[model samples]
Target: MVVTVFEAYAGLARRVLARPAWLGRTRLVAVDGPSGAGKTVFAARLADALARLGSGRPPVVNTDDLLDGWDDQLTFWPRLEESVLTPLRAGRAGAYHRYSWVRRRFLPRPVPVPAAPVLILEGVSVARAAVGPELSLAVFVTAPAALRLTRAVARDGPSILPELRRWHDGERAHFAADDTEARADLLVDGAPTLPHDPDRYYQRIARHPRPA
Candidate 1:
């Protein structure tokens, strides 16, 4: 009983549509996972699946954009709540400025987050208590630590491995305190996600595009 990606996505789409809208005008879906656990790709695929079902292409807001830098970590939640989540919760357009790693500063422009019927929020700490109550579906994605570290290094380079390791340590502590995995509506095995094509997962992260 192996489920293909399409099947899995279809199931996810069904679950999303079936659930009552939790956030004001939108069904907020959180894709919470460790680094290199395929959260980005899974969110994209799920968004695609939702669109195919006529749910309209939901916008994805990565927590990466909200972070000040590698050190900022989960500390940017207040900004996210005020700028994005709060507005969306009121059924208005949410807005947030994206942090630019290259520039070492947040872009002056505000990225518009529309009040959508469904929205995919992917990245670590996305499903923590502050935002969890507003989420219609909370998904926790996980892969083997060795594999995740390897994938992360392949994407971020070996020079930052120590930093990534430190980041993971903080994430581990946060997750323990938050019980993120325990609250997930779905726990996805990220290993098999995007099996055939891997580049789609890295393109957004590795290329470091200006945040939308």
Candidate 2:
């Protein structure tokens, strides 16, 4: 039967919580994909699902907040590692400066990453090998290239297409080098479906409780 995105995530979350700990006290979930592959929306739903599963609302850290601009794609990772991942790994609240696109600067306000049972890091390259071992479950979400491009342009305006294209090339090379998809614990088809068994997603999680 057709299920809402939230319903799909509920099934996925149930299985994630049923597994063994891979990231110590905090379950680190990496939702990595291309720019327009719906990572943000999916992460939000998954956080809600985790809360419904009695894990309390999982704090989500968007890599977008860590990026300076188009050139900073994977380069902003180290900052994320230091401010967010490191603290959370040590079972403490993580703090980071949030970047402002308009001001072209990182705001002084610190974004907090609560040490919860589950934490979602959503953005491109989030599942890269650099942080793989620290992740409990790594999910790779994707859609048709043409569809993703279209969605990106529509969301960011046509003027941003050139930047988007350049970013895509970098993402492609990074994923290739990291073999992200091959290493993923789960691959999500980030496309709207008609009537289909959403439980299949649950089954995938059941089979691969932890990313290899």
Candidate 3:
């Protein structure tokens, strides 16, 4: 099946630069959602779209690298602030190292993040679990449970099916009270999501502006 994608530089740019309150300047685009929601793929494509639309080309960051060894999961949250957020807020170039799961160590190479008009941070909690107040925009991607489960199993492997299920359960529980989804500026449908245009699989990322 041919996957559908939406990229409208003009429309996205206008929606992004919503008010005098914000700027295309130093924008942080955080793409959040559940696992198996295709956050990685969406981030890559969105970054490409934003680059084409905006004045300054934003750099992309994957929180996967900042992660602590699987043993101390999520410990890297503070590191993201120190390494990525601080420089972004300072309007300076920032550098960070990505963890190599295969090598079981962090690769020494640094991800040089420019303080462009925008920055794309794509991952599970690029916004939810981490601190990124400079986030000019935040998007949450969601899909049906069955579709997400199927995608997770297909991508990760059947052996991971149970583990992924548990992760989903935990995520739902965590987000329930926190209501990050409730506060989303946008909600993207991941798998088997639909649109007002029934024939269209790809919909412009839903735009619900934040009051701030």
Candidate 4:
């Protein structure tokens, strides 16, 4: 499954990275999935693919880093407005100090994201909830609950199973309620054993029309 996910995600990344890097144009690419759906791994692999395809650098802005905290967990709409959302809208790179949930606040030092042609934001609700329609692509990954639970337990250890299971259920429900899967520009399966290449995946999105 990991292999398949890697290739599929890498395929999407290649499409994104292949774009011309115009610092003047800021493009946001969001990857959304359920709690155990493997968005983070896909995002990184895709970023790498994009870099390889473009023969350039790929900068990433993860929602996890900017998140407020568990108190407002999965509620990234607010910080995004003041941080990534506003800056990107202004045609400026969004800059912000990454939040340290364990510390209950953001780090003092700020991180500068370039206003490059592509910016990857990967997380649970990134695609459906944040950033109004300027996305070059909105990807949604999915997999069976049984498979996801297996992956989660493997990654987080057995102790976190109960909590992870709950989170996964909640995320799945939210996506369904939001109709995100039906609206996804790209969807990838996370259960297969084959590698999901990026180039092919991204070309699919490039060919998809705008949501009506």
Candidate 5:
């Protein structure tokens, strides 16, 4: 049955909380999807839901903030692994410098991620195979290519269309190699056709069936 966005995410929060902490003392929730596919918004809502169901607000680390530039794309994982994941895996607080797209450099100050009961990591390819074992929940958000491009252009402005096109191409190649969608525990419709309260509800395409 269809559920409100809070109901859906609250239920997920329950399941995640019931699971053992796979990323050290934190339950790592990876929200991965293509650019402009609504991963950020969804992650924020999910984090809120998780907070309602758990102790405190879960920390969300957007991979986009970690990138060096347009070229860094997937290659920024190493920096994330070193500054965040590795330390977190050892039950320590993690911190990382955010990249300023306008300044084209890493910010001098670091963002701290305290070791909490839950952590939400959102961005394209954040749920890659290497992270599978450590993930408490892997959510893949997606939308039609045209809609994705349009939304991206609207958000980032028309000037980025050329770079966005190239970015989309890279995403296609990376997703194909990673089989990210198939590996996801939950598949979310970033651009849902069904009628619902956009702010309070989300369309879930499907939940991956578990092995018997």
Candidate 6:
């Protein structure tokens, strides 16, 4: 059946609300994908849809904001666990200092993450095997490698091209080792060719069949 973008997201919100809280008292949703796959945009829209569905505005903890720097990459998970996940797992509020890309350090004030009914974790490897058990929903967004690189350069600037290329390589290795895409409950096309409202609709991608 054809589902509108709004309907798709609202349906997902319903499914999430129906699930038991796996992260203390919160249902965690992980939006994982390679860089420039539009995970941030998708997560934001999903959060809005969830709010409209009566889940309230969920707090989105971006892994990028938790990273110490560009090199920190996948290693930033520990900080997130210690500062955020652990607290929430205990049915309490969590807080973390946001990292400043310009300063290359964490900011002074800590951002509070209340014990909301739902939480959106958006980043490259937030859906890795280690966090799989706690995830109520795992979404993988993707686009062609060339297109992704182009988008990254466009958003982050041509000056970041060199590091971005290395970053992409790291992401490919991480995704392969974690088998993230294969484990995702939903696969979204970051760059869809179909006509739809960008703010309210996203094109869903079917997962590739795995070999027996």
Q: What tens-digit string does per-residue lDDT give for candidate 1 at 67-114?
A: 999988989888888998888878899989999988989999999988
**How well does model 4 score by local distance difference test?**
0.67
lDDT of 6 at 210: 70
Q: Pick the candidate with the highest TM-score.
A: 6
Better of 2 and 5 by TM-score: 5
Show model 1 residue runs off by greater than 4 Å: 1-7, 193-212
Candidate 3 runs further than 4 Å off: 1-10, 17-25, 54-56, 71-73, 129-133, 192-212
Better of 1 and 3 by lDDT: 1
Q: For candidate 3, lDDT tens digit of each residue in 101-174?
A: 67878889887877676777776666673443556777787877788888878776898666566777766866
Alpha-carbon lDDT of model 5: 0.88
What are the lDDT scores of the predictions, listed in order? 0.83, 0.80, 0.66, 0.67, 0.88, 0.89
Task: Write model 6 residue lDDT over 1-212, tens digit each, in one string.
Answer: 32323236767778889988899999999999999898999999889888998657999999999998889999999999999999999999999999999988899999999989999999999999999999999999988899998888888899998888889889999999999998998888888877778777777876455767
Question: In candidate 5, where is summed lDDT lowest over 10 consecutive residues?
Answer: 1-10
Which parts of model 2 have CA positions greater than 4 angstroms off?
1-7, 196-212
By lDDT, is 1 or 5 better? Answer: 5
Clashes of each: 0, 0, 1, 14, 1, 0
How many residue pairs in model 1 have overlapping backbones?
0
Clashing pairs in 3: 65-99
Can you give the TM-score per candidate against the true fold? 0.86, 0.86, 0.78, 0.75, 0.92, 0.93
- The positional error of residue 18 in candidate 1, measured at the CA in angstroms, is 1.9
Question: Candidate 4: misplaced stretches above 4 Å?
Answer: 1-24, 101-104, 129-132, 158-162, 195-212
Q: Tens-digit lDDT track for model 5 on 19-91?
A: 8899999999999999989999999988887788748889999999999999988999999999999999999
RMSD per candidate (Å) reads 8.5, 5.1, 5.8, 5.6, 3.3, 2.8
Range of the 10 consecutive residues with the lowest summed lDDT in candidate 1: 199-208
How big is the positional error of residue 46 in model 1, measured in Å on the Cα after superposition?
0.4
